[model samples]
Target: MPPPPNYPASARRNGEEGVVLLSFLINQAGQVELSKVLQSSGSSALDEAALSALSQCRFTPATENGKAIAIRVTIPYVWRLNQ
Candidate 1:
């Protein structure tokens, strides 16, 4: 599994919680590129943190005809504070 984002202290204190939907490219090199937030988590801190963390992930590049290719994908990062 990819590493999880660090919860921002201010956001945590404010009890902010939501899902950040992100669109990004997984390049042929299995590296993340050209990421954008497609949906906000209602908190900039959470959104930014999700972006920063997910950007560090390395994905298995999509393959076609036994060759790697870049692909654009959308995924959600969920944030919630424990009760």
Candidate 2:
């Protein structure tokens, strides 16, 4: 699925730009199970946005010895202000 289009306009207006590190556990069912913010963007709004987007993301399950296995993945979101 495509990413959500709910980014806060204020963040852009304020020229907010930072990296959000997201840690999530991909279950055997190829679905996102646990999601957490490994690193934040300093701004609560940006962090929340990154977390929300990641929560809705789907990923291919990890494999171990030719079988699906739960695994952890880290995603980074770099939000840059339009120049």
Candidate 3:
């Protein structure tokens, strides 16, 4: 499972909440080779925090014809404050 993103203290203090859409390439080694923010959360701190956490993750490599292959994927990371 992908690790949860760390909530930035500044964002929490400001009650910032939004979804960050990220595009990344997962290589055959199951490592994140490249990543970028496709959509922002309206808060740089939250967006950055999401990116940093994602970089530390490892994923199962995609397979093609029984061989591991790299793939590009996009996903949304949601940030919300607990009531």
Candidate 4:
């Protein structure tokens, strides 16, 4: 799947960088099951957008002994505005 769209232009205009810490559950089918924001950027809009984008992502499920298994993964999203 394609990457999530960039944050809104207004977010860029604000010129703030937010680090979103996300915890996601990867299922055996290589689909994302659950995603939660472990750390927020103090901006609800940015946090929600990051979560939404992540939900659309697909990943390779972790394997153990050559078998797929559910696992939790942490992802960090850094949004920086170009000056």
Q: RMSD per prediction, one decimal?
A: 1.4, 2.4, 1.2, 2.4
Off by over 4 Å in 4: 1-4
TM-score of 3: 0.95
Candidate 2: which stretches are off by over 4 Å? 1-6
Ten-residue stretch with the least lDDT total in model 2: 1-10
Global Cα lDDT for candidate 4: 0.78
Error of 1 at 31 (Å): 0.5
Q: Write the per-residue lDDT of candidate 3 for residues 1-83, one digit (tens) a residue.
A: 45887789999999999999999999998999789999999999999999999999999999999999999999999999983
lDDT value, residue 60 of candidate 2: 79
Q: Tell me each candidate's TM-score.
A: 0.94, 0.83, 0.95, 0.84
Which stretches of model 1 miss by more than 4 angstroms?
Answer: none
Q: Tell how far residue 22 is off in model 1, in angstroms.
A: 0.5
Per-residue lDDT tens digits for candidate 4, residues 1-83, read 32654786666677656888889898998888778999997677778888888788888878999999999888888766652
Which stretches of model 3 miss by more than 4 angstroms?
Answer: none
Which of candidates 1 and 3 is the stronger one according to TM-score? Answer: 3
Q: lDDT of candidate 3?
A: 0.91
Q: List the residue pairs that clash in candidate 3.
A: none
